[model samples]
Target: MTDAVDRAPAHVAASAVLRVGGRELDLARRFAVMAIVNRTPDSFYDRGRTDALDAAVRAGAAAFEAGADLVDVGGVKFAPGPPVPVDEEIERVVPVVRELAPLGPVSVDTFHPEVAVAAIDAGASVVNDTTGIHDPRMADVVADSDAAIVVAHSLAAPRTQLPLPHYDDVVGEVAAFLRERVALAEEHGIPRERIVVDPGHDLNKNTLQTLELTRRLDELGDLGLPLLVALSNKDFVGESLGRDRDDRVAGSLAAAVYCALHGARIVRVHNVRESVDALRMVEAILGWRQPVRLRHNLRPEGNG
Candidate 1:
């Protein structure tokens, strides 16, 4: 029988690399972990734990030390609450980006063109636009810089309520949306190598719709770009397992591993160490990564 690793999708091949922030992320050789460094006071998961500048910097440094490949800094909460002005958003995230860029590649999670430009100027290497570049200026700014862009699919604008979000076919629609956005990004002068596509989970998508997208996520790889998935304690896991945000680590790890096996290149996660460990285990099993120590059954003396 053919080894399962041999059947891995084309997107996960060793030659596939994602360029961002003057670095080449070997997506196939080692799955990339983009740790969450939220600077938002009302973040759903941490709930203001990293809102303070010092706390945010410490959290990002610790995640990098714990094996995270990059840190994603975001000031405003993705959910609706209050409008954060462009200047306020810039103030919240740019400081954290300036500090964390020295540790590893920094990804600024924002759809605002001004915020993206500010973060990039502050040393951020990736602009993760969850609104899928609804404002075309976002694409323009990213194109002008040497940074990469994550084109995420979301039905509504940030901080807007979209009750009863509908999709005739969630996976197909998401794939189509990402494809179109990626084309637009390229048209805006952002090179194909500097682009990543995300099927934004739980963003204007109900639990059932999110679950369907997760199941058929591989279809998105047909777009032939690096796939970045933000599946860290999302509402889908919470609703599916009946667990709160704080209790969804195991479920999140399970979903992350499944996605990695199915060709997900990068996973943006809140629990960095756990997500890193889970992805490393999957990578080792698939022969993409080597075990740190392999002396378990190699002792000549036999079992003690």
Candidate 2:
């Protein structure tokens, strides 16, 4: 079986691109980057953006300008915590969603059904719910629109204080969960063309689980939807690199690029420029017809 590079002259990627609203994301080849612009004060990353809407807007603009095809704007963190109310969640995210939705393809990163409805009603083109359609109303909220839904497989709600959960087969379970939710979305009048799958990397995963997921990416590809991989600065990277969140830019870029090269179609990231650059290099390498020659192999074309 020949890979994408071997079938060059423009091989169509296994990935599919869907138009959320006015903007169109390039999901062909390796998945394009969807940079995160967290609009929350307590998010694991970019916490300050929530305190000021202007900063959040600026960050969104920068993410787009830097090469993110879509800016994922979310006000809440999926960490272990209490459930946030609908009104408060709306208050935290709406302004940024409104401001950034016009710039490009804007996706609201939320799990609340009301939040999803309001965000799309405002200007967001895609509803990126991390709950895998666990909320009863989430499926119906965007049932009629062209807006896309991401069925992210998170083990439990963000606030659940369960002991470190163990999955005998994490990838299999995640794929099953996402597939089930996709069915649920279809039942609620959502089109198959508008569904994407996300294996919730940090929601309930440890370092080993996350790393294993990356290695076993093909396990989730069977769902036959665009795969969005968010590998920004989570605790795994911190532990691996012995660096704090702020210092995980390099690590995040590495993971994002690695995932894309391996078949991920939508890389949700933070350092948009760095991730784009890394993927470009990977594409050039895997995409090349032949390897580059060193200077020592300086035979003339005729002499060879």
Candidate 3:
């Protein structure tokens, strides 16, 4: 059997650009940033607030102007803990979607099918499913709406408690899993051009597993779809650098920078300001995002 992990992802199977309102997410461009808009308290990134819709609106707009080509809004906040009810998720995210989708190309990060439908009705253009479409109804929602989807590979639960860490080869397992799900989505009527893959960083796998995935991140590009990296300031980033959650800004930017170099296109981070500046520097040095794809050496010659 050809292990999907051993194989490399060429491009995310996305052939067409995701047109959100007036913004065109041209995936052919090297990479882009999708600012995190958490309208819930329990998000793993611990971002924006659900109660304060107006403030959250401001945050979304600011992210758009701050070099964010897309804004991802999450109402249910999936972390390593209990899941919120579908009704609560809808109530929290729908209003934000209704308000922000008009403002920009907004994506809703959710797992519940009901929540997905509500978000779509509220004008969300994308559905980011971290579960890899475990719920059958999830595909139905996406199929009915015909929205762009992000199918990330996850295990155990959205929050972190697990039976135990288990993977023969961590990176290989994740890549294979995502590939299978991508196929599964196709089976369920979702076209290849509308999907993106994410190697779930902190949702299911342990710190070591995440590091392995990051080390071989380019492997995902073989899928031939535009890649999206949610390399925000998470617990694993802290574990690696011996830093705490509050101090993972540099680590988050470092992880995102690494992902970008490895062919991932969209980086999801909490500290948008820092991530933006770092990617700008990346564009300046690497020239990947430049008009000519600059090809400058971010590192000096012979540094290796």
Candidate 4:
């Protein structure tokens, strides 16, 4: 197998730290988990379970208590659905941001400049623009605030479906797109430390493409920015295991671990507690974090 460093472009070097939401994550030493809290009624996973203001607030708090490093509140579903006016989007997300901000770092998953600005004003520290900050104004919003931006690679606008996304080399193409987006972000005043990149997972690709991308995820480190992989209960996981959305947790965790071991520094996930435990175990095994307890097999007195 080719080494991860060997796979990376020799001309580029990976980033060592990620700065976001007044927090600095040492990418080389630890991984952070960003919990998903959707305020949309038609979210593919939870399906309105958290659309209510109270429910959304509770969910975000619980996720943080469960060891999530950050909470991502998204007002609109990522899938192609009816258009949600900007005002409604703000109304749905801002209050949640206001409530969650005091607890921990909050990320607003949006592509609209207006929504991003509102969320930032409401105390969000990150703008997760799945459209790769296609709107220059979105970049301005992040630049104007102390928040960071998550630039994701997608072939089409949100709510628009690509018939069949194709790429001669998915990893290379995605890397190229992210490099351009990252450069655009810098051009708009966002610094490299405050910018993160996402591979967009099943955003525009099919199962095969997504799997291939996962296989070569380490190549993306060449971009030298913190990598965020959102692999929570995605279509690729379900399809790969011949399971449904509700049954993809195991596969999701597997893929997330694989990505983290490769190059992912942050994982955006729906199953916060499980993902947290899984990643913590990985961290401990890699010696980034010490084991919570070393009683097991230490001696006969402490042995189970």
Candidate 5:
């Protein structure tokens, strides 16, 4: 098998500008925190906590106040369960998107092209497709709108169970899949600046595969686009640490740090405050950001 580094393309600078909903984000200088706001009753993490429109809106506002750079509102859970009709999905996300648009950049998590269109109409600037463009029309919908698109690598349809995932090389395969999807988006008229890619941590992967992907995440940067990683209390971390969903904060933060150091420019997380702090610390360490109000360590010249 070829080494991961050898298989990766030549390193290119991470995308500098990402335009969504008329707002431009400078990815080179700062990391983005995408807070998850699930409107589905059966979401794995929240589990109906924000299923109501009002509750979802409140959660979005709180996430923004907690320092999230973006909020991703999803109408359906990714796990298999009851099917959500297009109208129901639109109803679930459109209102929340409309209410949250003024707060910051809003992204709608869905694979349905019609839902994507409605969410964009309601002020969402990005479509977070977990199926990696399962619907052929999704790319066209995004291309016709001003919204950006997140092309996540998933081997199966959303909400379907992958009993066992077998990969010759997880990271390499994921990168190739995303590269193809990115080209598909561009071919549909969605410019490079309006696209992002995700490795879909735990979506169709087991624990070991996810860890390998995390360790070799930089290889995805060779695609020459900003990387978005969803590492918020995921099953991979939980299974690795023998912890439950609520107890995976520390592990999640550690994974987030690793991803950010490697090349991930955006992190989708459930804990906004901690993720914000962790990413900022990583950026400061990398010299991409500065310390806030530094004064505690300064020594007086006369005393010295």
Candidate 6:
């Protein structure tokens, strides 16, 4: 029997385009910056910075203005805590999704099928499931709508703490998990084009595993789906540089650039402007994107 990787086509087509809601994203021509807008008070990064409805909306709008290709509106903290009922989760996110949808393409970060349905009804174009579709019904909701789905590889359920997860070969295991989840999504009627895969850095793995996944991200490209990497202020980068959350911007950007070079098409980030700049630079270097202007150091003829 052929290995799954071996069976995958040698060269997947480039110039990929993904349509989400009314927006068209050229995955091959440019890297997408997905800004995180959290509505939970206990979120790992902001710690309730945008917990209020108005604040969340403003945050989403600001991210769009800062060159975010998409904004991920999340209501619940990923770490274990008090249970946030589905109704409350929907209450926290749907309003923000409704208000932000008109600004640009919006993605709702959720693992609940009910919340996914409500957000899609309120105008979200993508469902960012960090649980790797533990709730299989979420796939059905995504399938019934025109939204794209982000299938992240996490070893445990959402908000649940686990003993340090172990993997024999982190990259191979991640790729296999993603392939399985992607297949599950397709089985539920989500087209391959509308499915994105994420390796779930730091979600269930340690810093070393996260770094290994980053180093071997290209292995996931064989899945023939666009890759979305959530490396924004993650613990791996912070731990690697001995920096705290606030000081992890440089490290995060470095990791994001590395992922982009290794075939990640979308980077979910906190610092939208810096992430956009870094990604655009990488795209320019790879010849996928062009510089804004070329006259910086070129002297006019007969002037030099």
Q: For each of the candidates, give the backbone clash count.
A: 0, 1, 19, 0, 0, 0
Q: lDDT (0-100) at residue 179 of candidate 1? A: 86
Model 6 misplaced stretches (Cα beyond 4 Å): 1-15, 299-304
Give per-residue CA lDDT, model 6, range 108-149, as digits (tens): 999999999999999999999999999889999999999999
lDDT tens string, model 3, 113-192? Answer: 88888888889878899888878678877876658889888886555567667889887888888888888878888777
TM-scores of the candidates in the order shown: 0.95, 0.87, 0.85, 0.93, 0.93, 0.93
Worst 10 residues of 4 by lDDT: 4-13
Please report the TM-score between candidate 1 and the true structure. Answer: 0.95
Error (Å) of candidate 1 at residue 158 is 2.1
Judging by TM-score against the true structure, name the best candidate.
1
Write down the worst ten-residue block by lDDT for model 1.
7-16
Of candidate 5, the 10-residue stretch with the lowest lDDT total is 4-13
CA-RMSD of model 5: 4.9
What's the distance in Å from true for residue 52, model 1?
0.6
lDDT values for all models: 0.89, 0.77, 0.75, 0.89, 0.89, 0.88
Off by over 4 Å in 2: 1-4, 7-15, 288-304
**TM-score, predicted candidate 6 vs. hidden true structure:** 0.93
| Per-residue accuracy of model 4 over 1-304 as CA lDDT, tens digit each | 2343344323122667667767776766677999999998899899999999999999999999999999999999888878899999999999999999999999999999999988888899999999988788998889988899999999887789998898999999999999999999999999888999999999899999999999999888788888899989999999999999999999999998998888888999999999999999877766666788767756766445
In Å, residue 203's CA in model 5 sits off its true spot by 1.3
Considering TM-score, which of the candidate structures 1 and 5 is the better prediction for this target?
1
Q: Per-residue alpha-carbon lDDT of model 1 for 1-304, expressed as tens digits?
A: 1365685555553337778879988776678999998898899799999999999999999999999998999999899887989999899999999999988999999989999998999999999999999999999999999999999999887789899999999999998898899899999999888998889989899999999998888787788888888989998999999998789999999999888867788999999999999988877777766689867658655655
Error of 6 at 209 (Å): 0.7
lDDT of 2 at 249: 86
Cand. 5 TM to true fold? 0.93
